[model samples]
Structure formats: C-alpha cells, structure tokens
Target: MNTLLKIREFDAHGGPSNVKMGGDGHAQTSTTVGRFVIKSIEKHVSYGKYAAWSGIAWGTDIRIDGGVVMVKFNGSWKKLTDVNAQWGKYKNDQKGVADAVLKYQRTLYPDSPIPTKWLFNDFGHVSVKYFKDINKDRKMNGKEYIMGDFIHTTPTDEAATASRKIFQLAESHGCIHVKPNDIDTMIGNGYLKKGNTIEVHPYTKKAIDASHKRDTAKLPFEVHFYPGIYKIAIYKSI
Candidate 1:
C-alpha cells in the first residue's frame, strides 16, 4: 500500500480550505483548516529570529510562501507539555525573539523585508520534523539540513501576546502548522509515520489552476509505490 500526503493551501490572505488524505485513488478522510500562516519576511540574510534564505530561489530556500515540494516525515511525533516548554527547550519563541530581531532589522536596514508584527506559538501538543534528505550526507557538507517541521496547533499564552490574532492570518517563518485535533485523529489511525511523504502546496491561483488542469496526468507531488504500505495524500484547498 502506498500513502500520499496531499496538502492544498488556500490564499494566505483568506481562510484555510480542506485537506484530504488516502491511499490509491480513494478518499479516506477530510479535515477543515483551523488556521495556518506562511513566511512574512522575504530576505537572504539570517536574522536572529527568522532563518535566512535566498529569496531568488523559491523552494531552494526556507521561505515556502508560494511553492511546492515533497518531503518525508523524519521521525516519530513528540508531545510537548506546552508552548512555554517548547520555548525553553528549542528557544524558538517567535514573539520575543522576532520582535528583538525586527528592531535590529529596522536599525540595520530601514527598508527591511521583515514584517511589522510577528507571532508564533509551538504546535501545542505533538510535533514532527520533515526533511528532503533522508541521509546525513547533505548535512555533513553544510547544505540545507532540515527541510521543515510540522506541529499540531493549539491556543496558548504565547499566542495571545502577538498583535495579530492566532489562527486568523498568523504567519510562520516557514514551518507547516496544523490543528492539534486534526493531527491527533490522523496519528490515532497510524496514517502519519516515518518516511511518509508530505507535499506542501502554495495557495495561489496559478498552482491551483495548474493542479486542476493536470488532474488526470501524473501530478508533481503524486506518488507511486510497489505495494504493502499505506499511501496518504493531503490536499488543501483555498
């Protein structure tokens, strides 16, 4: 059995659409988009809060605002106690750090690409990292180490501090943020697993139109397998 994870993202300015998952050509389950965000800062320089990447190249960098790529679930899921717990461990507090970084960005470059308001909380409960390179070869040479991470979304204290409301249009630096309950349901059924491919799609008219046009032919993120394992695909609509 082959599993496909199809994600169709709607326009970032609007609400999230539906996400579908299944094996073969059949649909298993669908979920509504609670809330998600994309990269607001677009630059190549590394800011303390925001990871730096070349804006020239779309998918080659960390900013995945409007792009598509296939990545595998790197490992198992780990449930964190709370947003504070994640901040203490990973030191990825977007609010505090991004604010300081944005201040510095303003001083260094008055016309900085960094957004005015930034707010991001940990996935809340369970989270997983996805990567393009399974092996550590690229990492050893100092190449793109981790592709991106996925986390279950839950309302938290950290989320409240930001000027923007959580789950509305709250943007991420690059990571894929999802609703906690939705992911919990999927994990409960053992649908998501190590080595499962996650296809990230941008919520753009061009990409959506192209996908619709190529509905019949083999699509960009469509997967094929010999058999035995379950194939899951997540399609997100705008």
Candidate 2:
C-alpha cells in the first residue's frame, strides 16, 4: 500500500449526506474490501454488471457516476466523511455479480479506456485475503463480496440543483462517494493515489454531530460538534 488513507464511514444522518445500506435501508456493514489501488480511472462506467440487485437504471446511466475522481497521500486513517474536509457516504449496494458486464451492453459504450466489468477507479484492492485480486488479474472476480465498488464522482444534475451546487452528497452502490471538487483536488494534489489503503470503518448507528443533541445521550463517549468550519471536541474517549 502506498499510504493508508483509512477511509472511516460513520453512521449518522444530517445535512450534506446520509447513507443507509441493505435492501431495507439499514446500515448493513461488515469486514469487506478495505485496501486496493487505482485500478483505472474509466469514463465508461456501467452498473449493469450488478444490475439485478442495483436496479440503478441498468445500462441507461453511466455519467451518473462521473466527476474527477482521486488518487492519495499520508498514511493515517481518513474518515469517509469529514466536517472540515471532504464529505462521503458508504453504501453496501452489492450482493454479488451474476453475469459478465459486456453481456448487457448493446448500443452503450464507456467514456475512454473502458474498465473491466465497467469498474471505475477501484481506489485500491481490499487488503483482505479473500478480497485479494485473485488470479493476479487487476479486475475483480465475480465471486468477490464487493465488486465494482469505486470511490469516484456523480452526475452534476442528479445530486444537486442549479442554485445550490455541490449537493450534500450521497452513497453509491457498494462504495463511497465524495464531493466532486474534493475528489479532483485529492487526485490533483497527490492526497489520494493508487496502491493506498482504503480502510472502510463499518457504518454504525453511532454518529457525531452538533446539530443533534438528543442523540448524544446514547453514545458511549462524548463528541461536541462545532459549526463554522465544523470541528469536533472529544470528551473522555471516543
């Protein structure tokens, strides 16, 4: 791994973005893909590979997963969402793949160098033994728990309105989606790169936000959320 960009995903709902997993909209998280490399920054990203489950427009929408994308730096943990930095949402939208991606394509095509199974930048392969890039093939095998889970951008029109650009952000199937410019900036400034570790700290009901005071009583530790730049004040231990 280049440097560990430990992408931690917390469980909370508020402004900006809120993520829920599973078919019932639960935060179904577990030990899954955690580290990998920038497999490819593709333009032609298709979701048809996992369509039977994703049901996210099948082959009609590709740019729905567009934007600049990132590449990394540092060697510490990075929360998928940050108050003062890039915001994110982790969603487990994958059950698994049933067929080859090309099988669903007819009149559709990817952006430039089309990625295998339409997988955009993989962020990096999960460090787990089973999730390893088996067969030494950079492509994810269909048998894997999470395939085609990428950390990239989304279509400008879907997430936001013309007046309030940069929508609060949302979750993309099986992966995490961050603010567009933040992603671009990460890749441009080398804060994010291929071959780095992407540690997805499973989502939980526990969250930290100043906007909600009623829920703090449920937390084991205490976290004070400060507005403005959005800061966190930890009391005792978290």
Candidate 3:
C-alpha cells in the first residue's frame, strides 16, 4: 500500500486586547493533506489573562494514521471540547512529535520539493540503527557506517554519553527509520556529523568510550545495534 503517516495536533494562543469589538472569540484553523487530516486552531479568551475571567473555545482532536507521511484535512471534523488539565500536555506532546517528524524527514530528504509525494514514491521505509555513540562509526551489524542525529541532543546534555540513548530511541520510534546501507550514503556524502558522544543506554544512562574524532587510531571502540526495531520505512525493493 502506498501509505503516508500524519499526526494531528492542538495549540493555544493568548494576548492583550488587539481587538475590542462588540464580541470576542477564538480563531482556529484546520488543515488536511490527502486522506490525512491535521488542524491547528487558536483559542482566544473573552477577557485577558489578568481579567476576572474569560471564556475559552475548546479545540478539536483528529486521528491520523501512525504510518502516514502527510495529512489532508477535509474540514469535516470540528467539535468543541471542554477545557481540561490534560489538554495542555497532549497539545505539547503532539506538537513535539509533529515537529520532530518534519525535521527528521527534511534532513533525510533535502532535494525533494514535495515531501509527502516524494516519500510516497516507493523511495523506501524507515530503518532504525543502533550505535555505541555519535562518534562511533560502527553499525548495528558490526559494519562501519556513519550515523545521523536520531534524536536531537539537548544542549545541556552531553553528546559523548547520549549516542546510545539516541540510537535506542531512534530504533524504537523513528518515523523514517533508516538502514545501514542508507546510512552509508549519508557518511559517504559527509551528511553525518563527525564529532560527538553517544549515550550507550538510556535506561541506565551509561555511555560508551568512543568520541567523535576523524582519526580512527585516535579513538578506538567496538559497538553493535543489539537487534531491535531499528529503522521504520517503506522500501521499493522490499
């Protein structure tokens, strides 16, 4: 099946009285791509945050396939929901997933203008690669290959220690999961970064000894993927 995955999201916006008309209401916008639907709307309050109180316009929830690369909204699903505590958390997490998916997709396919269409053209599926650290050049199967930034490294966090954690996270839930061969292309073309540390295990917060250095002799290490759901994508040959 020529399938794509799109995630739905919700967000909120509030500010001072830009408009003091006879009435006040929130403006929400919805979007769709193909069979997939995603909508983002703003909820404005009748009174400012400092005001006694204000009425809220509840947001809607749309379901998107986990495997979809694009979304197509039909303007058919719009419902008012009661404002709740969990809404904020859900909105934040959903947006994170959406943003991460887009960022990773763009990094992987920079030349393609039509992201969804290009992804749908039987280009391939996602593959997860496990590594000891960001600097380590070994693939999961004991082969040497370059690695991409599976997860964004937090500035405060140390890269030399988070490579493994990134690999594991990528293996578990990477959208456009990649394989070792594809990773080779990234390495050959210098798309992969050269220096950084990788976390070995997220659960334990342990780290491997390898650090990113061009000279292999300068840094010596051995690592493996450990065999898991590493990379998730649709392959043309497969």
Specify the poorest-scoring 10-residue window by lDDT in model 1.
223-232
Candidate 1 lDDT, tens digit per residue, 46-138?
Answer: 223322211111212111112211111123211111212322343444455445435543543445345332222233344544444434232
lDDT of 1 at 31: 20
Work out candidate 1's RMSD over C-alphas: 17.8
For residues 70-103, could you state the per-residue lDDT of candidate 3 as single tens digits?
2322344321111323223344455554454455
For candidate 3, what is the lDDT? 0.25
- Runs off by more than 4 Å, candidate 1: 1-121, 134-144, 157-169, 203-238
What does candidate 2's lDDT look like per residue over 1-238, in tens digits? 1111122222211112243455634453322333343444433323333322232221232321222211111333222122112122212211111112222322123233331232222221111111345443445565534334455444431223313454554334444444545545445543344432233322342443323222112222322222212222233312
Runs off by more than 4 Å, candidate 3: 1-118, 121-171, 174-202, 211-238
Sort every candidate by TM-score, greatest first. Answer: 2, 1, 3
Ten residues in a row with the worst lDDT in model 2?
Answer: 90-99
Candidate 3's TM-score: 0.17
